[model samples]
Target: MHVLWRGDTLQRLRLVSGLILFTFAATHFINHSLGLISVDWMHEMQKWRWVVTRSWPGTIVLLAALLTHASLGLYKLAGRATLRLPRWELVQILLGISIPFLLLPHIINTRIAHVFFNVNDIYVYELAKLWPASAIIQSLLLVIVWVHGCMGIHFWMRLYPAYRRIFPLLLTLAVIIPLSALGGFAVAGSNVAAAIEIPSVFANLKVLTRWPDAAASESLAWLRNLARIEFGAVLAVIFGCIAWTYFARVAGPKVTVAYTSGPTVRVPQGPTLLEISRMSRVPHASVCGGRARCSTCRVRIERGSYGLPPPVFPEVVTLGSIGAPPNVRLACQIRPEHYLIVTRLLKSETAGPEDIAIEEADSAGVEKTLAVMFVDLRDFTRLSEKRLPFDVVYVLNEFFGVVGAAITEHGGWIDKFLGDGLLAVFGQRDGVEAGCRQALRTARDVDLALDHINAKLEAELGRPLAVGIGIDAGPLLVGRIGYGESVDFTVIGNPVNVASRLESLTKERDVQLIMSRGVVRMTGWIPPAALTDQVSVRGVAEPVGIIMVKRGRELPADVLALRAEEKEKEKPAAWTAGFWGRR
Candidate 1:
């Protein structure tokens, strides 16, 4: 069989059809609102509405739009791999698909009654035939159609920059429009009820009903029966589609999609990555709910790209408009055929207790330019031997907090907690220059925090403690290394190893902080006073030049000073005679 429409064409057609339907509903509501003035005025306004919507051309548009919209909606619903969606999206779907079934009875009693029973398709005819029940039922149909149309508008306009600003005004209209129609409808029903008690009003209503007494009751019963059958059949088809969706999930081939945060979810091959996230109860952000209308559900593919299909036209247009990276694609559009690994591009969007805990993606072997800082306690081993094990643990915990605050305060993220030391990286969010500067500032502050910790301990144990800090900057691999839920996000490279050696050198050199010339150069800052020397680092034969920064010197660099309170902190001056003599 030949397909008549492409997905893109169908999408546009759905929009056109929905707009057509909304227009009809709006006019019908306006006619109902006229009942607030008088029932006769309501009928008069409806005559104009009938010309606009119930005439030959209008009827064609209305019927064609209804069939097209409902069919396309059901087709899309069946094609969706997973039904897990945001509450609003689910509500819109439920209400829209319910339109055919819910309005069947109203459709029969009016249009069918007029055809078979010779009743006028007007207010007085409705009063004579169905009376009170018709008003309430038609109002229910109006609400469902209005809400469904409003939801369509919301999904289309939410990504526009101005939508958020105008949301309140739009929401008020959404509520008031349907409510006014219902209120006016109730008033018209009351008028009809009052007319039943008055002879003149009843005489006027009798002219509208042309139902033949002999056939009227039989025709009305047949109409109600046909409506009930249509309603039941539509429900069965909808429920069957839902059942098929469930069975497809259960019986389809499954593929693994691994997240950088150590979650490996197995999902059926047909669903988009966003659908898999939803099916697995992973909170993925989809502001437009997988229709590719919003790019909130973007992901950066880390591995297995060869197994995925090329971007379709819709995905291409959306990604191009946003200027997304080549590796990044909307999760809602990507349907993977094989194993894959990915990281969420926008972690903040899925930030809630129910959402999957998203942290920094581990860059296994990917190289990055970063500044590494290593801080180690000089006398921790001897102190741990002297103190009780419980006390040692307590003291180490306290020390971790102090050093952690200092590193974090200077914009460095802790990479790992060593036995008596910690390794940190800077410039992950910024660049190498800023990272190097943050490492320098952190080294100084950690020295100060160490001093404070030592002062408190000195009063308790009559001995002060000391710490050594080393800073180095270079390209290194930064990512998760462990497996089976024991993953660790860390950095490893010559620079990291060199920094550790320098930290060890502080104990021998008896200085508070040691840094390589590489760190200083990376920071792009000229220092006032600093001790300089060549020290052999492990795994390297040639000695690397190092700079030992002293206390009370200013760091006069733009990269370091930007949004940081570390300008007055360090001054690196060349090591004069006997720089290590005091220690």
Candidate 2:
């Protein structure tokens, strides 16, 4: 018999079952919330709820989902190769384990009793029988089940953009639904207790419910004890799996893994490369917790490729989906069989939620022709040295605000801010020529914005702040890079380095802006027919050809006309005053 234990198939099964279980829990909680109105209302809702839940089809599906979710959850736990888990994952596991123990007693008391002993397990009957004594246990079950379900939903949905957009509303409902249910449960229980104090209400309930006889009551008590013992046995088996896993680690033969990033580990032969990295305290990316969902944990096998086993179907599909090269394999899926040398293809710290959208190979990190711009504040440091720190911060914020707006306005993203400057990239979506044009336009707009800001802050400043702008365009590896929380989507290549050098060279050349011949060629823009010089830039083998602008105000007549057209567009229309005045 062929067993379907593929990681992707198991993940899908886990998700579908979890959703079904969560839906049932949510509906049950809503039904309990009706108890806040009256005990009769709670009974009314229970009848409607049971119409579906107690039906044969509904019962079959619910049981299947419950069993699947529980078994798969435990299987995942047992299959874990490393115990070094994130805090949230640890919390989720603990909560999930606690759920079955808390849940079994409630299920037996209701569903089992209703089927075997003809007990009417409605809200009214349950509240009358067990409310005052078993209230705390029931309440704990209510809370634990709902929270476990929510965490499961959160873990999967957090990978999606739509879920994140409405997360606030979802969070509000998560809190309010459980609180309402708990309140209703408390109020209804008290009402039932109060009503039972009178002889008529208490006597009426006794007749309505099929109060088990002495023998039946004894059988029910025996069943509950049996359930407790069985559940304890299950716990023992689970714990035994954990113990065996640890023991096997010591008993098994070890394989040597030499990571190109410096760590060399000798781990048991059974674990995957990602687990080996974790065991050795070497950082490796696994954005989806080694589920083979995200391709972040991919690594290149530099050596021992010939000896390595071929990838399984699921791993092949995942790797193929991302257009990964032949040498690359998912570190989370491939278990090294012998001594191997590998390098993590993606930065461990730079992986984030944005990785979900990175389907194309270029976004994962490939050489692409794009524009890079570097802008820096000139002489503002010495100017700020004489002012209060707060004052300097205020000015910097204003400076960044205008410069940042100009960059984005022309189709670029701010990569990072150096102390007195910022790096920006263009042409991620648009083509190379378009990116180059956008970068040039942004440079012109930055000069215009600085003039406006300097005029605004002229009273406080002894002189206007000057800025140096540099533009370069070429093939660069653009992608998300960094470590942990400091990760960013940016570019890294010769173009980035050259742009920074040109920005620095502006200070020496006493020019406001500098663009390499490559940028000028891409944009097809002609500079004034004057003395053009080639300057040797650091890190480049040969001198780079360039163009320079002494002052932004000295830009070509056609380019300066853009600022005039912008001003003309900004002027309010004659009828605008009446619109606001009427409002």
Candidate 3:
């Protein structure tokens, strides 16, 4: 039952129905193009239309499915009254509303013509004769129907993982198929006009009777008949069930959690802290949708630590990998059976409540400086394509885990993961000097961690991995962005970009670690004896002193062993340390 109600199932149904309709429309257009081949071919195709339309149970199912799909879409639009919808969705809604109206005349002129008039020979000749002057409107209607159907298919395909992987290919096909069919139709239309002989009187009459009014009236009559049937009642019932289920299942209940002071938040039961935070307008950043896949939502159970259940398999693995403290847990996986206060360590807009709470907390303040460290993988593009997709993801996750551990171990907070890099901000939440020192220490630790990781990779895959680290110190503006239902708390400033750029220059300088001059002046922490100099970076207009960070002899025996493995390989193991120096 749960499987049946799964969102993916409904999404699949929508996709399949859309594909069926798209195929039918494409084939129908190609058939219409038969006029280019010969009038006899077009007439023969018209004869088969009655046979196809009345085939055992196909017509009934086709009508039922189309009506059901349309109603479901309408219900979704009606439900989002309170939330702000994207502009693309609004355009899609408008297109959907126009489809039935534009399609009515075409449907009646052909289907009703055969049913009522028994005019089995109503092919492209009849259509061209009746509406020769309205070709532009007919063409526009065809394009609109095709575009709308394609949009529906695209929307449904986005829900599937496999489909997403091949989205570009699918998009290419969607474009090509329609254009090819249109080309075929244009050729057919030209041929039909050239071959058919039209009397002067008939040509004059065609222009006079080209208006869509009569066809529209016939369509309205068919719609009136449909509205009075048991089929309509069945459709209404099914639509109501789908709407109720979507609202109940997809939207769920609105839950809100409020944070007063400190890191703790009081939330209702049932929802995990991450869910409550997100749904309640709290600013929390969860890059991986609170699936315990990433530690972006880690929080400290400061007050009610005992009330929460122990971490599950995924939560336990992720927590252990990052070396989280006993009191710390992933907010996404922790579903407290009772109300509890949990201190959110990562201050994101989605995790924190209101701006007032943050302001008040600052007013009743604690100020400290912390170190900020940035580590970026070198030659990521080359590495990405060198391995399988899964391998690339695994290597990145492992790299981030090691880097994150080094930061936390040095008493620094990880601001965010910048794609193939790590951004760790040390001081503002703690203290200036402390932050600078921690940043240096983290850089040293990262050098050591990478040595270990690379040694393991070399032993496993016969190759080495390289990364660059940059440390900087400065003030930053941190706050939540978004309102009501969506919010994300993030740090922004020049220092962040400077730190990133410094990391970028590491590969060119043959250095693994670099620190800004501001860091050196502020912290008074010198690099290990083996490290080297100051170099000028672009944009700064002045030389910044940097160090060539290396694994120190004092590193743990296990770490030293890993370094020894690299040393034995006799590969180029030099790194430059400076503000900006080209090797």
Residue pairs with clashing backbones, model 1: 363-479, 527-572, 528-572, 528-573, 529-572, 529-573, 530-573, 553-570, 553-571, 554-570
Q: How many residue pairs of model 3 clash at the backbone?
A: 30
State the TM-score for model 2.
0.69
lDDT of 1 by residue, 21-66 (tens): 8887887787777777778888888778777676789778888998
User: What are the per-residue Cα lDDT tens digits for candidate 2 across 1-583?
Assistant: 1112234778889988989999999988888898889878878878888999899999999999999998998888877777776566788888898887767777877888889889878788888766789889889988988888898787666655577669989999999999999999899999899999999988888778876778977887787778778867887887788779878877988889998768788888888888889878898877667777667788878888887789887788767766677888899888888899987766665455543443224236667788999999998889998899999999999999898777767666677789889988777645677777667777877888888999999789888988998888888886555533333456788889889988998998989888898887776677765625688878889899888987655666554333432443222222211211111
Q: How would you encode candidate 3's per-residue C-alpha lDDT over 306-374 as one tens digit per residue? A: 677787766776666455668878887776655455655544532211122222121113222334577
- The C-alpha RMSD of each candidate to the native structure, in angstroms, is 12.6, 11.3, 18.8
**Candidate 3: 10-residue stretch with minimal lDDT:** 574-583
User: Which runs in model 3 stand beyond 4 Å of their true positions?
Assistant: 1-5, 8-19, 32-51, 129-131, 194-197, 200-583
Clashes of each: 10, 1, 30
Between candidates 2 and 3, which one is better according to lDDT? 2
Q: lDDT scores for all predictions? A: 0.71, 0.78, 0.57
On lDDT, the stronger of 1 and 2 is 2
